[model samples]
Every structure is written in structure tokens, then in C-alpha cells.
Target: QLMSVVAVGDQLVQQQHFGAERIQERLQDTLGNWNHLLDLAALRRKRLEEAVDFHQFFADADDVDIWMLDTLRLVSSEDVGRDEANVQSLLKKHKDATEELKNYASTIEALHTQAGQLGEQDRTAPEVVERLNSIDHRYQELLELAKLRKQRLLDALSLYKLFSEADGVEQWIGEKDRMLQTMVPAKDIEDVEIMKHRYDGFDKEMNANASRVAVVNQLARQLLHVEHPNCEQIVARQNQLNHEWAELREKAEGKREELNSAHGVQSFHIECRETISWIEDKKRILQSTDSLEMDLTGIMTLQRRLSGMERDLAAIQAKLDSLEAEADAIEAEHPEEAAVIRERITQITQIWEQLTQMLKERDSKLEEAGDLHRFLRDLDHFQAWLTKTQTDVASEDIPGSLADAERLLNQHQAIREEIDNYTDDYTKMMEYGENITAEPSTQQDPQYMFLRERLKALRDGWQELHQMWENRQQLLSQSLNLQMYNRDTRQAEVLLSQQEHVLSKDDAVMNLEQAENLIKRHEAFLTTMEANDDKINSVVQFAGRLCDEGHFAADKVSKKAENIADRRNANRERALQQMEKLKDQLLLHQFLQDCEELGEWVQEKKFIAQDETYRSAKTVHSKWTRHQAFEAEIASNKDRLVRVQQAGEELMKEKPELAELIAPKIKELQQQFQ
Candidate 1:
């Protein structure tokens, strides 16, 4: 049991030595990690100090060093726990310090960039100077506390150099100093001049330095108080001068506008005056006597003048309108003058209208008067033509003269109607107030009354002459009929005398019939002549003589017709016996006449058959045959005896011998046959 105890003790001693070796190795490894942590912290602290030195905002560099030292102390402590918890605590402290150093470094970098820009700024301005002073104080503080001496010193010296080179501040300070130095008392005018010059110079310098305005203004007040003895009076005088100058400028501008308006008004007024002159001239022309005597040429001239006047009036009106517009532009200033001009224009327009009306009335009156005058002349010519036509109609035939006179009367009537119409027109003109000075007199005019009376006389005379001509024509026609009746009576008497010796019953009967026709014609002529005797006095005696002659001829023809009737009754019974006796005597005469030819053919009494006897038939076959042939040959001798007896009666009137012999034989044969 004691040997086993001794072996346990030896085991315990070996285990203790092995445990000591492991603890020493673990401590050595932890010490090495702590040393590395210290080195990293130290490097971070050094960089943080350098950042703090470069810019004032990095002043947190000391806090990083304190935190690193505390962490190292914890790591090197003998009694402290060097376990995982302690190591983690130490690592956490180092990380916190490192993060703080990074934050500081970032802040310092931004501040350094700001300081660099500030160095280039105009430090003469108050806000910039103030900011520079504050930056300088912070830089000095940072320089004293920073561990990186070289960078801190460099940053502090740069801020100092920027402060020193700020020329804008020196300029501002110099201006203020000059303003104060130039201040002087105004004991005399010369002193005032000298101080005024000094203030002018200070104002000129401060005008360029906008940042030094407050100090410059303060100094300017001090100088003004010293330079002027009565500062308030001088300021008041200056203000009054400025006020007067403004008033003068406004008045001058108003005067310029007024002058322009006045020129326009004057120009328009002149134009109006000229237009009025033209109107007056036209009015005078319209009132003239020549205007009343309106010929074509004169009327045309007046029309041309009126046209020109109208154009002038239009021009004047246009000018007036332009003037009115111009007046409206300045009416606020010149209302009374514009109103007066407008009134004048209105008056001129009224006068022009009156003149135009007068001219038109004058033209109408003149034209009416001219028409009346022409009508009067035409009436005179018509009267003369009518008188000449009346003279021509008196000497002409009824048919021709009446036709021409009626036509002339119609023409005269037409002209008279036209004259009446013209006179009515003239009366109308008078009623309408047309002053027709040259109008011909109408109602009391001698020529018109004379023409009317003459026309009535001519119509009456034409009717009387027409009646006379009709009476004369009837007398002439009756006279011609009387002459024809006398000629026919003489012709009937000659026809009755020619039939006085006609013993033939047929010839005497024809004579009686013709006498009856003559008697009938004579009765008709007597009736016509008796009917027209009163109307035709010149033919009454000649018509009575013709009637007597016609009655005697008709009575003679009737007596001869009665003789022919008694002779016809006696001849009827003896006609056949007379015809036989005439034939026997004609045979005896023919036989005795052909005795030589018969003696040659038949020496004493025998039939001689010779060529001459046969050709002439002068020989008889027997005494009895010869006698019968002789009787036949003389049978037509009765017609010859009748013709001879009638011819013999005509010969008896002429006392011819053949009539005496033939009449005796015809009378003896007629007595024997009866």
C-alpha cells in the first residue's frame, strides 16, 4: 500500500509540470495577440492625431489614444481575466477606437477642404473676417493638442498666412480711417470747401467697397456734420431745387403737345375758310341772271362748277373729320376750341345745302321757260301755215281741196293741243314757284286769240264754199243733159225725112216702130229736164226747145206711118196683079231689047240653032215656049220694079227723068191691079 502511495505522488508531480507547460504556451499566444492589437491601435492613434493636426474639426484624436491605452492596460494586467471574454472586450475597445479615428479623419478632411476655400475668399467682408478669426482660434487650439506636430504647425501657419494677406479687409479699414481723418469743423466757407472735397474723395473710395458700407456711412455722417454749418438748410435747398426741376420738365412736355394740337387746328381752320369762299362764289353764280338763262353750255359750266364745289366741300369735310379726331386726342386739354371749330363746320354744311337747293330750283325754272318759248314759236308757224292752206283751198276743186283742207285742219288742231299742253306746263311751273322771267304771255296774249278766231272763220268759210261748189256742179250736169236731148231730136227728124217716099209696107212699118222708140226717149228726157230745171236755171230754155223739136219729129214720123198703113191695105189686094203686069211689061221690053240677036239666029221667024243662040238663048223653040220662058225670066223683075220705084221716088225729089218714067208705070200698074 506504501509503494502505491509513493507512485501516486510521482504522477501528481508530472501532471502539475504538464499543466504549467500548457498554461505558459497559452499565455505566450495571448500576449502575442495583445501586442498585435496594441500595434494597430497605436498606428490608428497616430493617423488620428495627424488628421486632427491638419484640420481643427479632428480634435477627437486624444479620445482614441485614451481608449487604446485602456485596452492595452487590460490586456497586460496580471490579475485580470485573460479569457475569451477579456479578449473580446479588448477587441471591442480597439474597434471602437478605430471607428472613432475614421470619423475624425473624415471630418478633418472636409474641414481642411473648407479652410482651403476660405483662404481664397474676400476677407474684407465682415462675415468672412469673423469666420477667419474663428477658424484661426480653432486651428491654434488643435495645434496645441495634436500629437503630429509637423502637420499641426503647417495647418496653423497656413491660417495665419491667409489672415495676413487679406487685402480686402485692409482696404475696408483704410476707407473707414480716411472718413474719420477727413472730418473737419465748418468755421468758414473755405473750411467748408476743404471738408467737402475731403468727403467727396472718401465717398468715391467707399463706393467700390460694398462690404464696408456701414463703417463708411458712419464716417460720412461725421464729415457732413463738421463740413456744413447749417446742414438741415443745405439739405432742404437741394430738395427744393429737385422739385422745381421736375415741375419745369412736365410743363415743357405739356406745352409741346399743345403746340402740335394748335398747328392742326389752324390748318383745318384755313381749309374750312377756303371751302367757305368757294361756297360763297357758287352761291353768287346761282343768284345771277345768267344762271336763269340756262343754255346747254351755261348749264354744263354750272354743273362743272358744282361738281368742283362738291369735291372741295368733301375735302373740307374730310379735314373737319380729321381735326375732330385730333381734337379728341387732346380733348382733355382743349375742349372749348374743338367745340367752336365743330360748330363752324356744321354751319358751313347747312349753307352748302341751301345753295345746292337754290341752284337746282333755278335750273328747273330755266328749262321750263325755254320749253314754253319754243312752243310759242311753233304756234306762230302753225297759224301762218293754216292761213296759206285756206287760201289754196278756195281755188281748188271740191274733192281735192276738201281733202287737203281737212288734213291741214287736223294738223292745226294737233298743234293747238300741243300748245295747250305747253301752256298748262307753264302754269304749273308758275304755281311751283319757278321764276320764269322770259315766259311768253298766255291768257291775255293777242297772237293766240287771233289764231283761235281765224281758225273759226276758216272753218265757216270752207262750209259755205263747199255748198256753192255743189250747186254749180248740179247746173253743169243738167246743162250737159239738155245738149244731149237736142242732138237726139235732130237725129230722129232726119230719120223720118229719109222714110218720106218709102211706099213699101215693111219699110213704112219699121219707120213707125222707130218713131215709137223716139217718142218714148223724148218723154224720158222731158221728165229729167223738168225735174232738174230749178237746180239748173241755165239749162231750162234749152231743155224746152229740145222738147218741142222732139215732139214735131215724132208727129211727122206718125203721119208717115199712117200713110204707109193706108198704102199697105191697098197694095195687099193689087200685089199679085201688079206682079203679073210687071212681069208682062218686063218680057215685052226684054224681047224688044234682044231683037238683033233673034233676027241673026232665025232670019224672019224660024228656029236658028246657032252657037250664039245656044250660048245666049236668044231664040225661042216656039212662040208659046218663048213667051213662057220670057214670063219666068221677068217674074223676079217685080222685086226690081219695087226697088226701082223706091229709088225713083228719091230721084223724083232730085227731078231725074228715070224717076218720072218709072214712077208713072209703077202707078199705072198699081191702079190697074187695084
Candidate 2:
């Protein structure tokens, strides 16, 4: 029983350890937190520029606030710093604490490792309290100093981005300007002058743009404080370092005040221990931070984003150049249209205002680019939008309307040439070949045939169309009426004096054939009033129906009725009195000899109203009557239209080559009011 009691006592002696081991564990834990401490500092530094009021934020970062909450980690249960109790009586009582703890832990670990070994019970624990107490002075000081240095190092690491190569941006800007100048021509005096002005503008713009990037970088840096090197030399030898510091601190604390060193030896011992402890601490820290150290994911993303941003900027610049070149080419081709182009240029000048505002918005968005990849993606989008906006204005375009106009002009010019040729031939005959002959030529000249063709065409237009109502429905009747009833027919004019015939012949060149060709061309040249004429009558009828149903005037009626009713109705009574002048027109018309009175007061007493210059009621009445007759004829013209259409088709085929050209002008005249 005594032997068993001794064995149990021996076991108790071998297994015992005190607070010294716990202190080392606590220190290791403190070092572990340091990894996150440095990371949080970095985050703060990165975000500070955009978060100038970060301190004002009431919600603290969850895991990230650890560094700023430093007091939570380093303070002990005694409401003092970890190393604050160096001079306490209980602390001093543990004189052998440091060495004993190390020896005890080693033995215990060996025991557990060799649990089945023979005679393991013979092993004894060291005097833990005395050894730990002995090393307390050195290890405590070392741990405290390491903590302070680590804090400072973390501060420096937080601000690494601020010390970028972009600090030399001004130098880069200067070089860029020099490159821009070199790219421009300097040989021509005006070019040199323009380049000089451009250089000045570039200088200012670069300064402004550069300053923006710099200010942001500077703001980011402002929140970072310099770091102290809390790191110790890392290696497997660090265990020895911790052991040595523990011994030194234990020895020195026995001989001096807790806060200050005595002899230089004490201070040296304190420092050595600290350096050694830091090395051990660093080894542990390296273990915890290895994952973070190996990871370059965030930084690499930032770099990639920045690269993308640069590419986007380059693309935008290329697109802008393309737009500018197209605009310049368009301007160069139409020098006579310079006024219109200048107006477009003025419109483009307003684009600068819009671009400036857009750039201001872009500047704001740039700050949101947290990493290089995000920045690049955003830049691409911005560039595409910019390109689209610029392309909308400066892109090359075909002026279809102008092309149509030019084609019409060419047709007119060709007709003018033909007319000029005909006139030239006439002038030649008049000037050189012959006197004005009273008889037809005996010679069968081809030129005369051509002249006769032109005269016949002219006669067709004047006689068939303008000679009285010669509707083709009654061709014989029309011909008789034109020949006999209408005194002004071209055929009748053929019976006039020889001079009259010559004059009429001259007027007969633009015949129905030419008019038909002109009409066809004009129809093609003019813009269609509607997509097709099929809906024209329907649209008009629908609009008229709406107007009639509503008792409301249409735009056409409103505009015309306002003019007539407002101008004429207000003067109705005065206008009736003004009709006394019309009697004068009747009086001046000695046309009807001895005209009766207009209202039959007395035929001879009326004295013919004596004013031929006055506005004539007969003219107005004749116009109204002619319009009514034409309307009536139009109302009864179904068969006449069919006959005229057949005749038109027949004549059109006779000159099919020029038929397309003449159809438009003929259609124009034919489609007009009588």
C-alpha cells in the first residue's frame, strides 16, 4: 500500500505544470489574431479615399474591426495589460516558472508519446513555479515589445497601394504630350499655329486629368499610418529562441522594476528575449497566414480589370478617330454645301457639352471600380456607348434626297441641250442659209421633217387639248368643234397670216409627246404625297365626314374660311357699295355698243358706266361659269377618259424611248383643273 501511495505521489509530481504554459498559449493566440489585423488595415486603406467619412459610420465591421479593438486581445483578466503584473507577489513566487514549464511540458509530451515504455514512471517533473518565475522578466518584456512592433508593421502593410509607380504620373503625362506634339504636323505655318494652341490645351487637360487620378491615390494614402516590423526571423530554431527569452526575462525581473531595466544587461536581456520571442511568434503567425500569403486573387483581379479598362479606352479613342475622319471626308466632298456642313458642325459643337457631362458621370463610376477586372468591364461598356453616340453624328451617310434632285436636274439639262440644238439649227437657217420664205420648201430636207415633227407635236397639244373641250369620246365632234367652233385652235392658226404661222410653228415644238415624257419623269422625281393614291380619296372622305358630323371646320376650311370670311364679311356692305365701279367696266366696254343699264333704270341714261379699268363683274362671272362647265364636263367624262387613255397609250408607244421621260409632265397637266 505504501509503495502504491509513493507511485501515485510520483505520478502527481511528474504531471504537474503551472500558469507559465498557459501564458505561452495566450501569446500564440494573440499572434494568430495579428494575421486578420493586417488584412483589415489593408481593406481600410484601400477603401478610405471613397469613404472619407468612414469614421462616422456607426456600424463597425464584424470580423474586420479586430485591429481597432486592440484592447480586447492584449488585456488580461486582472484588468491590466498582459505583462502588467511582473512585480506582483504571486508572480514573483513563481521564480522557476519558465524553465520548469518547458521541462514539464516536454516530459509530459514524451510520456504520452511513450505511454507503453518500460519505467516511464521514473521520470520526474521540473520545479515549474520557480523556473517560470525566473524567466518572467525577459519573456514578458519580449512579448510586449513584439506586440508593439507588430502593430506598427500592420499599419505600413495597410498602405502598400499608395506607394505605387503612378506617383510618376506627371512625368508620364509630359511624355504623352511630347508624343502628341510629335505626331502632329509642324511644317505649315497654320498647322504649326494650330498645333501650338492644341499643345496648350493638352497641357491643361493632362494636368486636370492627372490631378484627378493623383488626388484619389493621395486620399487613399491619407488614412494609412506607417507599420512597425513586429515580425521575427522565422525558422524551426524559434523554439530555442522562446526558451532563451523566457530564461532571460525570469532572471532580469528578479533584479529590477517591472517597467524599467536596471543595468544595461537587464535591458539587453529584455531585448534579446523579445527578439527571440518574436521569432517564435512569427513562426506561428506564418503557419496561420500561409493561405492568405499564397492568395493573390484580389490583387490579380484588380490588375486584370485595369488592363481591360485601358483596352476599352484605346478602343474608344480609335472609334472617335474613325468618326472624326468620316465627318471630315463628308465635309471635303461638298464644298459648295459648306453652309449646311457648318450648321452640322455647329450641332456637333453642342456634342462637346453632352460629352463633358457624360465624362463627369464616368468619373464618378470609375471610383466604384474596386478591382482591375471590374474597372475594365465598366470601361468597355463606357467606350461602346461613347462610340455609338459619336457614330450617330459623324458616320458617313448617303443623301438620297439630294441624289434624286441631281437626277432631275440632269434630265432638265438634257432637255435644255435638245432645245438649244434645235434653236441653233433654226438660227443657222435664219442667219446664213435663207431669207424668211413665204412658200413651203421644194426640197425634201430631213431637217425639215424633224422640224415638222416638232411642229406637229406642238399642234397636237394646242389643238387636241387647248382648242375647246375636245374629249376623245366624240372624236369627230371634237375635231369639228376645234376646227370651226374654236377660233384659237392651232389648226385655225395655221390659216392665219404667214408670220402668224411662223410664230405658231415656233411655239409648237413642246408637243403632247414631249409633255408626256416630261410628265412621266416628273412623276418619278416628285415625292409621293401618300404611300399610294389608293387611300387618298378614302382619307379625304373620312376627314371630311368627321368635319361634317362634328360641325367643326377642318384645317383646310379653317385657314381658307378665316381669310375669306374675316376679310370679306367685315367689308360686305362697303364691298357692295364698291360695286358702283363695275358699272364703269361695262361703260368702258364700248365692246357692246349702246349697252342697256345694268338694272334697267334707263338704257341710254346709264351712259355705259364709263370705267374700263374698274374690276369687271363679267370677268369674275366668266371664271365662275367656266369652272362650273369644267366640273360638269368632268362629271360626265367616263367614256371620254377611256378614249383619251387609249389614245395616250397609242401615242406613248410611238415614242416609247422618250415615253418614260414625257409621261410625268403630261400626267401633271392632265391631272390639273380645267
Candidate 3:
């Protein structure tokens, strides 16, 4: 019935298209119904993003909770491990969380991007176009939030590295100074002589540098308030220098104290950290001796275990051999089924080889894929950076696109307004046979007055909806059945509107497909990578076994060789001590019968001149040794300092921006010296 009415109206629309009011009504109804469907589809797509965002929120919250719990556990521990003040772990945890959030934010950002793409499909639908604007606005706000969050994390991390390093340096310096004060007086005569060579300026310089670092760190933090990247980069560079300087100073101070104490020391100078470190290693080796023996026993157990696997493989091979022989004997006995048996055997063997090769390739590919994972991840991010920084993708330019959209939107606005102006309520009521009219008229009977006045106003245009409904009854009939063409028509309109909204997304989708496909492959590739890792681990273990075999022989030789070298190095100091002892006994032997020879011996001693000026030769000799030792130590410190400087230079090279920021300060310091 509705179709017959629409067919009558369709004949009129065929003559007038939308130029006539009746035809225009049908157009509006169809377009409105179409827009509604498009809106629903867009809504469905948007809900997916909301779902993803909800998932991300819960996951991120869980991660934050886990991190807080882990940190709390360590903080609450009554018996803290050596790494109680593990700044690295703290930094790493913070870094990981920051990065994870960035990843999630980026994904949300990508969805925002996808929504933008979806928006492009709704250009013809005014309602969808409006909704697109709303989404873009929301995303722009979210984008700003994400960027600020990342920047804040970076600022916190920079400050943390500086202060954390300062704390470590301070602790180290305190312990070093304590060690210097608590160390016992020089024992051996030769040790006292050696001490003189190595004890100047190390502590003094460290104390000064520690002070410098503290001041510099405070200055940097104060200066780090600027929001600009240049200012931030400058402060971070300065803070880094403070950290490096603090490390160098404390290490240098400790090394100096060590040098001073090492003079005329025992067989191994505990001052040479490597010496004590080696001793500790030896002790640890002794401690783990039982474990090593157990490991040897386990190796035998492993060999015994290998026998079982070998037997299993051998049994499998034997079954295959027996099956082949049985097939041959069957063929000889009954030739009729010989061909079928041969065919089956061939098929089985072929399938086995194919399975083995596939397994091998799967393992190999997985490893290869794993090795590329980091590179792929970096590459992926680099691509993301490109997308983020794309010249065409402008948040600012969206307004312009929207302006174009709004212009078209307003044209529809004009059309709606024009229709609204003419369709007065009273004019439509008379056409619909209601007891109302456009004009206030005097008639004794209310019904006649209402009907006559409304009829007189029937020539009024499409301002009123009732007039639209009454005059265009055929249009209304057609509209009531709009559900028939609802989905297909609206979806197409919505899709068209979105593309025109943001032109860049249409441009970006050309690239997004490739990336999406690659991401899809990532999960499968990760599994393969794990399998490959096992193979690589096996190779590593085999290499370690080979090294262990060589180390067994090398260990025996090292034990013998290192001892001989130790004895040889100790020879010079032992001789110096002996001479001091001999000289000390000189006074006791003075009344010997061979007085002249004794006098000559005394004369030839380094401490005494031939002129016999009552020389305390031993004292003088010890003083000279002290002077020489002090000079050597200073030289060693200078050499060590050069090493630290070189390392710092190399570090600065990698972070060249740091050099650009710091070189001015260094130059100013140099000029002050000059």
C-alpha cells in the first residue's frame, strides 16, 4: 500500500526531482534515514576503540600496581641485599613503565587516527560529519596529554640520574676516607719506602671535585625549570657531567689511598683492588668446589641419560629396518601386493623427510626472526615517528577541513531554513482537515472559521511540517518504507563523508596496510624466534664447553706462572728491606777488629757520604724512597685521570649534543686557568 503511494509520488518526482516541495520532502526523509544508519555504523566502529582503550587502562593499572608492590617489598625488606640502593633497577622500572605507557598511548593514538580515517567516509552525512569533528577534538586533547606525560618522565629520569650518582659518589668517598684513616701504620721498611711514591693529591682532588659536583648538581636542578627543549637538553648535559665528575673524583680518591697503603705491603697488596678481588674469586672457587664435583657427577649422569635417547633412536631405526626387510620378504612370497607395500614405504619415508625438513626450517626461521626482532621494533617505531611527524597530518589544518565541511553543512542549513520558513503550523492543519487555520478570523461557529481560514492559507510554502506531511502525503508514504534502503544507502554516504573530512588519512591508508600486515606477522614470528633461541643457546653452551676444556689446562699453567711472577716482583723490595736491616746493625758492629773495612762499608752506604757528616743514612734513604714513591703515585694518578677524561670524551662523542652544550662551560673554566 505504501509502495503504491510512493509510485504515484515517484511519478511526480520524476517530473520535478527535488525542485518541487513535495519532491524535496521525499529527498529529506531518505537522506535523514540514510544519515541515521551511517551514524549507527560509525558508532559501532568507535565502540571497538573504546573497548581497546578500556583494556589498555586495566592493563596499565595492573602494571603500575605490580611495580608499586615490587618496589614496596624491597623498601620494606628488613635484610636488604647488596643492591638495596639499586638506582639502575629503579631507573629501569621507571623507564619500562614510561615506555609501556607510551606504547599504549601510541596505540590509542593510532585508533584516533583510524577514527579519523573512519570520519573521512562520512562527508555527505551532516550528522556523521559533526560526530567526526567531536572525535578529532577529543583525540587532539589526548595527544597533548600523552606528549606531556613522556616529557615529564624524561625530566624526572634526568634528575634521578644526577642525584643518584651524587649519592653513590658521596658514599664511596666517605668509605675511602675512612679506609685511609683506619689503615694501620706502615709495617715493612720497604713498604714504608714504596708508600712515599704513591700518596699525593689523590684525596685532596677528590674532596674538591666532590664539592664541585654538589654545587654543579644544585645549579643544574635550579636551571632545569625551563620548558624549552634546548634548555632541558642543556641542564641534562650539565647534570651528566656532574655525575661523571663525581664518579671520577671518588674513584680517584680511593685509588690514591690504595696506592699509599700498598707501599711496602705484604705478598699481595690489598690496596690493588684486583689483588683482593682475585683472592675473593679464589675463595668463591673453593666455596663452590663441592658444586663443581657435583656438576662432574651430573655430567656422567647426563651421559648415562643420553644413552636412553640413543637407544630410543636406535630402536626406531631398527623398526624401520625390520619393516623394510619384512616388506622385501612379503614381496618375494606374494608378488601381487608387492607394489602396494613398496608404494606405502616410499610414501611414508617421503612424508618423514618432509616433516623433518619443515621442522628444521620452522626452527631456523624462528631464530632468524628473533634476531631481527629488535631491528624490526626500532624500524617500526621509526615508521611511527614518520607518521606522527608527517607534514600533511596537521591538527591545526583540521579546522580548515572542518570549515569546508561546515560550509557544505551550512548549505544544507539554508535549505532546511528555507523549508521551515513557509510551512506554518496553521496552514498544514487545514490541509490535514484539523480545526485550525493560519489566520485569526471572526466566525460565529468555531469549526467553519478554523476550516475556511486554514484553507485560505493552503498556498503557504513548506515552512510547517504538517503542511509538508499533508501536501506531500505520497512523500510520507515513501519515507515510511525507507527502512528498505536504509543500510546500504546510509553506509555509502557515511563512508564518503569521512574521506573528505581528513584528506591525509586517505593518503595514509596507502601506507597503513603494509604496516598492519607486518604487525600481524609479528606474533607468529615471535614463536619462531623462541625456537631459534633454543638452538642459539645450544650453540652457546657448546662454545662454553670448548672454552672450559681449554681453561682446564690454562688454569693449571696460570697457577704456576702467576706465583713465579709474584715472587720475582717481590725480589727488589725484599733486597731494600735487607739493606736497611744491615745498616741498623752497623752501629752494633762498629767496635769490630776490622774497623777500617767497617768504616768503608758505612761510607759506601747511600745514606752516608764519604766525608762522614754523621749521616742517618737509613733515615735519608727511607725519605728518598718516600719522595720517589710519592712522585710515582702522582704520575699514576695523572695517568688514571687521563683515562677517565678519555672515557668521558668517548661518551660525549656518542652524545654529541651533550658536548655542544657543555663545551662552553669547559672553555670558560680553561680561560679562568689561563
lDDT of 3 by residue, 164-225 (tens): 55566666656655555544435564655454433354456566666756765664666466
Candidate 3: which stretches are off by over 4 Å? 1-127, 183-191, 194-674
Worst 10 residues of 1 by lDDT: 501-510
Query: Candidate 1, TM-score vs. the true structure?
Result: 0.19
Compared with the true structure, all predictions reach lDDT values of 0.46, 0.38, 0.44
Q: What tens-digit string does per-residue lDDT give for candidate 1 at 396-470?
A: 332223344445445444544544555544345333322222246533545445444544554455354445444
Supply the TM-score for candidate 2.
Answer: 0.17
TM-score of each: 0.19, 0.17, 0.19
Number of the candidate with higher lDDT, 1 or 3:
1
Off by over 4 Å in 1: 1-246, 262-271, 289-292, 307-310, 323-332, 336-339, 362-674
Best by lDDT: 1
